[model samples]
Target: MDTNNFEETIKPFFWVAHKSSFSVCLNAGSYKPEIFETREDEGFEGNGYDWGSLARVFLDERKPHLAEYVRFDPEAGMFCAYSSNPESLKEFIVDFKKACEDDAVINDLFSRAELD
Candidate 1:
């Protein structure tokens, strides 16, 4: 598939909050994605999950260069996935979507919310 063309044709946004926050954005590369800490007033309510520690673990497991493009702020309990490579971004979306579908907790969380 021509992921670059596909990516260019769509602007997608995804948000998930559990014990932490995770978001995905397609076509966000041009926006110069950056890491920003979330504030307590932002309504991130969760317990027992250390977002910062999780971010570090995730980053450590990936290639070092990925850290340059992806941003994770544990303090704010958020992770932003962005990359200049459309194919990589597309792959991330596909993999994450499948994971969410397979995970009962994630499926239930999304299904119950009126995200629309």
Candidate 2:
């Protein structure tokens, strides 16, 4: 949330990383119909973003409470990161910001691969 940070500064790097990993999902052939054919199949949606999606991706399993990547410890509500290595999580946040800032970068990254 650094207002001074510009997307252009991080977009190129974000695109590279996103493409390398997400290209697989884009090309999964059956992914779209199987997972996205209907709104219901798409899990949760809001503002064109899946707010809790990252938690689901990280946990990859059902749990009673939402899996919080950044969590509050129950004993004292102390903040803790539940899932990834701290550096990786930081990089991901940066990448997300970059993607959001540059629509062209986001477009190209997704266009490079097909969801179906």
Candidate 3:
């Protein structure tokens, strides 16, 4: 897809949090699709949020860039995904990835998944 199309497709997946406290880029590449959500930690200070660490105890190989908030679920044998907003991560990411695919943006982004 052209650059314009690609941008429009991913618009929903990108957002500025806290006036640019940080920028989050959520992209779903080819694989078993998953979801993520962010939660508010009441005990913490302003915007108290935390996404647990990405576990790598048993991976055949490690992809650090693609392994944020990624964890191994002993029972499932798959990664347990997390999100900046865990509560809305799954649904938001699904739609976000779909939007990119629908616009043929995935082809362009597949190569850049490492940057995500």
Candidate 4:
């Protein structure tokens, strides 16, 4: 992998801890998208940062390997693997970032940068 290029891609954005208002996992590869509660119920333990992996599914298809978000309160970028393969999450983060950029509500949420 081109570690430097990957690092470069991630570097421009500010890392912030994200609390996903809505989250789920899905078996979209199947006939229809189905939620995976097993992953959801795990809650905070679901992923180190507790990000919803399924959200990646909604991300830009151009980046098919959507992965993890770099949370700021947690305040550092840490790599975590996808469920089946280890590559999905990076693209997910990129897509998510784009979504936030394109949508105001999402961008607003991150703008406050303080949670109660």
Top TM-score prediction, candidate number:
1
Q: Candidate 4's residue-wise lDDT over 6-113, tens digit each?
A: 544543332232353222222122211112222334332222232233232343233443423321122112223233322344545455545534555343333322
* Model 3 accuracy (lDDT, Cα): 0.30
Residue 94 in candidate 2, Cα distance off native in Å: 1.2
Candidate with better TM-score, 1 vs 2: 1
lDDT of each: 0.37, 0.31, 0.30, 0.33
Q: Among all windows of ten consecutive residues in candidate 3, which has the lowest summed lDDT?
A: 44-53
Q: Spell out the clash pairs found in candidate 1.
A: 38-76
State the displacement of the C-alpha of residue 81, model 3, in Å, after optimal TM-score superposition. 1.9
Choose 1 or 4, whichever is better by lDDT: 1
**Residue pairs that clash (backbone atoms under 3 angstroms), model 2:** none
Name the lDDT of candidate 4.
0.33
- Where is model 4 poorest over a 10-residue stretch in terms of lDDT? 70-79
Error of 3 at 109 (Å): 1.3
Q: Is candidate 3 or candidate 4 better by TM-score?
A: 4
Q: What residue runs in model 4 are displaced by over 4 Å at the alpha carbon?
A: 1-4, 12-84, 103-116
Candidate 1 per-residue lDDT, tens place, 50-111, comes to 23332334344434445555553332333355455544444554544343344453333322
Better of 2 and 4 by TM-score: 2
Q: After superposition, which runs of candidate 3 have C-alpha atoms over 4 Å from their true positions?
A: 1-79
lDDT of 3 by residue, 4-39 (tens): 454455443453344413233433222312211211
What TM-score, computed on C-alpha atoms, does each candidate reach?
A: 0.33, 0.29, 0.25, 0.28
RMSD of 1: 12.3
- Predictions: Cα RMSD each: 12.3, 14.3, 14.3, 14.5
